[model samples]
Target: MDQYKYIVVEGNIGSGKTSLAKMISQEHDRELILEEFADNTFLPQFYNQPERYAFPLELSFLAARYHQLKKKLTALPLKTFVSDYLFDKSLLFAKVNLKEEEFGLYRTFFELLERDIPKPDLIIYLDKDIAKLQANIEKRGRPFEKDISNTYLENIQIGYEKILSDSGLNVLKINSGELDFVKNESHFKKVINRILTY
Candidate 1:
């Protein structure tokens, strides 16, 4: 378990990634690094008008992820770190949100910033069905997310899977539609045990 100095929990927008990461960090006493999604000024606007705000929103997220991860990972004495998101999530979202020409421009900057990111030792990907995901999203009751469609969520799901397949990192992909890691102790324990044994 010590071999996994850095671990990342990933999933679609409404997946239980943040909840799992929080629990793991609290129970296992690992350093937690959560993505500052609400801080992105363009996120609400992007949700309302993706075409107009997509580029800036993506760029903002890219810069934020790079800056936060670089600052926290390098300067902190975090032996075991659990983050809600992977750094390359910027690229994944950008690929989906940006147009071809815009993505080409974004990719150039992403590659340069990506070279500086320290890779995670293991990734726990929550693979949930779209129906469960939408339910979870609705339960959260974020206004910006209310407009999110199942098709959009599916696209993000596909994007996440594609990246995981190509990431070449030690990954544990779990079918998480039935697991309630946030409220169920047994389920959370199972997830924690899996990561530790990995």
Candidate 2:
């Protein structure tokens, strides 16, 4: 994290990536770019009927993330940046949730818009157990996330791990189950130290 100017915090739902990204931005006093998933009108339906709604939901996210990244790439200098979502990760969800025919159209649009986006300098992939992820998702109480099954979440978790494994990013793997960085200052400090030394 020392020389990195762009940092992307990535994880499955309720893995605390947004909370951690906010903390990093405040700690370093840098710019924070977060995902506005709740703003998507299709997200709730997508969560409830993934097979039917996956394409539109993923496409909406891709469009929004593309626009956000395009603006950031033009305006933000090579200073520190913490983003809750990575642009390419949109495809991860699309491929996982959408049918082959659906993903075909989704990929076409994604590639068209992603041509000019800046890649992250580092990606922090937060890891967590399925049960812990479900518990956290339940506690957060997003209306759309209410019916999220452990099985669906587990599929997403597996997809995330696979993506991170293949990505040549400066990835810092954190076990969210063990580290309650939100409430534990000392633990959070330790994580910061680790990131600083990375």
Candidate 3:
């Protein structure tokens, strides 16, 4: 944790990546970068009508993520930081949500923007089963996320597995289904120990 200047906690929707990232940043006294998903106007529309909104939703997200990271990562007296998302998460979701031709075009834009962004020194991937993920999502009670199907979540999980496996980045995968770091002090300590030891 001390050696890495930039760390990312990544996982599917409702897998508690944000919560874990926040806790780590607060505890470690590092800067925190959380994804601004709620700011995306296309998100709700995309949920209801994916075919009509997926491209724009993804494009908006790409631009937002790039701009946010560029601004935050550049405005430095450079302290170590933890973010809840990896920049390539855009590509992962785009691959799952877009058509073949749309994805090709999206990938071009992504590649162009990605070269300029600094990659995380380490990525902490939280892996949870579909049932657990769904329960968490329901617990969170975000209306836009209420309709997310198990199949969709399963696809995202598969995408994460494939992407992380092929990515040359340093990654730590955690089985988070049984861990409640947000509430249980022991669980939180276990997670912190893993990161510190890794």
Candidate 4:
């Protein structure tokens, strides 16, 4: 864990990536970087009508992620940093949500922005079943997220699998279907130990 200057905790929606990232950052005394998804006004609209708002939603997210990563990575002192998302998450979600032609155009912008961003040294992926993910989503009780169908979650999971398989980054995938690291201290300790031993 100390060898990794930048670590990314990735997972499907409601998989508790943000929570795990926060815990890691605090425990390790690393700087934390979280995705600002709530700031995007197009999110709720995209959920309500995906086809109508998919392109703009993805585009907005891409630009926002690029700017946020660039600013934070550039300004921060050289030290360990834990982020809840990978920079390529924009591409993963775009590929899932956009049409073929729209994706082609989105990829063009994505590739250009990606070249300037820093990559993570290690990626900690929280792997959870769709059932667990849905249950967690419901527990969170966000109105915009209430309508997230199983099919959509499955697609996102598949997208993540495809991207991660070819990413060439050092990745540690954890089976989190039964783990409640937030409330269970043992589970959290296990996660930390896995990172340290990996």
Candidate 5:
């Protein structure tokens, strides 16, 4: 925690990044930066009809993230920052879910926007099997997420794997199929130890 200034935990929908990020922040006594997914106006619509709302949803997130990071940079030093999501991964999900033409345009805009942002010092990527991811999503009981399909989750998992593999960033991959760090203190402590030791 002292050596690394910024840490990020990344994963697909219902992959438990937020929970892990919260745990890490508490363990290290660092400030937390959670994504405001519930505030996304297009999120529910995007989930219901991805083709129609994908670009708008992605764009909203990109802008929100950019503004949040900018504010953090201006207000705080980068010595103890932990975020649940990476800015670039927003584009990854968008590209994977959007149509070809929409994706092309989105990528062009993303390239233009990403240059202004600072990258995280490390990324902890949680990879869960599709079934587990779907199960977790259901357990969370988000009204908008109820209609998500297994195929969509599968595509997102593939996208995350490909990005993390070639990211040119330090990544710690965790098998998250059965890791319930939130309610289980011992398992959470074990994971925290690994993160600190690394």
Candidate 6:
């Protein structure tokens, strides 16, 4: 576990990746790198009108993800680091959100920048049922997320599963649909222990 730096805690929108990453970073004094989704001005519009906004939204996210990872990841020559996402998240969401033509263009751009970004040494996937995911999304009370559909989330989940399985990176998939790592100290400790054993 000590040797595994650059750990990524990844999941769908409401799967609690940020919370878990924060907890892990705080507990272990690792650098926490969270996705700056709020910086994407296209997000709210995309959720409202995906067909009209998908291309730009994905492109914006792709740029942001690449830039952030390049900046923060470059700093970690040693010591533990945890992030709420993987750079491949852009690819996953682009497939779900973009048209075929749009994704083709996006993929070309993605491939260009991907080689320069740092890959995670260990990726911990937190899986939750769609129902629970929706519940958590609602609990977060983000206005734009209120419009997010179950079908869309399901598609994202499916794409995520495929990408993670085929990622060719070190990954541990956890069935965390029932656990609340946020409020429960026991659950959080258990998660930490599992990560340590990795």
RMSD of each candidate relative to the true structure: 1.0, 1.3, 0.7, 0.7, 1.3, 1.0
**lDDT (Cα, tens digit) per residue for candidate 6, span 20-108:** 99988898899888999886889999888889999999988888888888888786676678999999989999999989998999999
lDDT of 4 by residue, 94-139 (tens): 9889999999999999999999899899999999999999999999
**Global Cα lDDT for candidate 6:** 0.90
Query: Better model by TM-score, 2 or 6?
Result: 6
How far residue 68's Cα lies from its native spot in candidate 2, in Å, is 0.7
Candidate 1 segments exceeding 4 Å error: none
Task: Note the residue pairs that clash in candidate 4.
Answer: none
TM-score of each: 0.97, 0.95, 0.98, 0.98, 0.94, 0.97
Candidate order (lDDT): 3, 4, 1, 6, 2, 5
Per-residue C-alpha lDDT of model 2 across residues 150-193, encoded as one tens digit per residue: 88888888888887888776788877778888999997898788
Local accuracy of candidate 5 as per-residue lDDT tens digits, 1-198: 577788899998898999999988888887789988888989989878888898899888888988887677557874588899988887778877788898888888888888877888889888888888888989999999898888878888888888888878888888877788998998788777777788
Give candidate 6 regions above 4 Å deviation: none
Which scores greater on TM-score, model 1 or model 4? 4
Residue-by-residue lDDT tens digits, candidate 1, 37-76? 8877899999999999999999988999999999888888
Better of 4 and 5 by lDDT: 4
lDDT of each: 0.90, 0.85, 0.95, 0.94, 0.85, 0.90
TM-score of 5: 0.94
